[model samples]
Target: MSNKDEAITIVSNFLEASMAPDPELAATYMAADVRITFTGGRAMASPQAITDFNSGRYAWVKKALGPFDWTEHEDHTVVYSNGTLYGEWPDGRPFAGNRYLDRFEVRNGRITRMDVWNDSAEWLLTPELNQES
Candidate 1:
């Protein structure tokens, strides 16, 4: 496979892993030296770290990421996605949504870096919007 194809496959597999209770597949996509920055000023190196933090949100809130529209731009591939995250929260609150911008940096065939930014605040305020979400 080409570098672009590898990147897409890695990302797709990672996404599948993310939905599972365990994040093993997600970690496979990352290089050991990978660095990631979450929107909340949380920065981590290992893919496991990324999963550890995100798992908290996923524990009770289900996230359905989808409709990923991809564009092959120069040497990079960008995917624009829209999805729904709907599940009951651990605290018994209905926490069921988040919109996001997920960016990946692929080198060779591994993801060396990733940055995630999302409209978490919007979901925090209104769970109902998730229908039209």
Candidate 2:
């Protein structure tokens, strides 16, 4: 497989492990010095930190994964994963169609950086927008 394909697979596997809430497994796909930035510019040092943050913000969550778009650079591959998030919130409110976009930098078969953005904050600010009308 090409480096691009491998990067995609690595990212896909990591996402699966993450949704499984298996931080140890997820960590396997990331570099030891991985940099992760979530919504609100929260910096995370490791996969376990991500799980902890999620646990606080969501009762349970999973991604409705979309296509993986990538660009290969001289030393690393930049991959973008765009999709909607579906899950229950901390308040036990089930929500769907919360769009999310994640950017990852994969180098030498491991993800070195990740940035995440999502619409959950907007939904939270105006919960009536998430209510079934």
Q: Number of backbone collisions per candidate, in order?
A: 1, 0
Q: How accurate is candidate 1 locally (lDDT)?
A: 0.65
TM-scores of the models, in the order given: 0.72, 0.96
lDDT against the true structure, per candidate, is 0.65, 0.94
Tell me each candidate's RMSD, in Å, in order: 3.2, 1.2
**What pairs collide in candidate 2?**
none
**Residue ranges of candidate 1 with Cα displaced over 4 Å:** 69-82, 125-133
Best by TM-score: 2
lDDT of 2 by residue, 37-87 (tens): 999999999999999999998999999999999999999999999998999
Candidate 1 lDDT tens digits, 46-74: 66776676656544544577655556656
lDDT of 2: 0.94
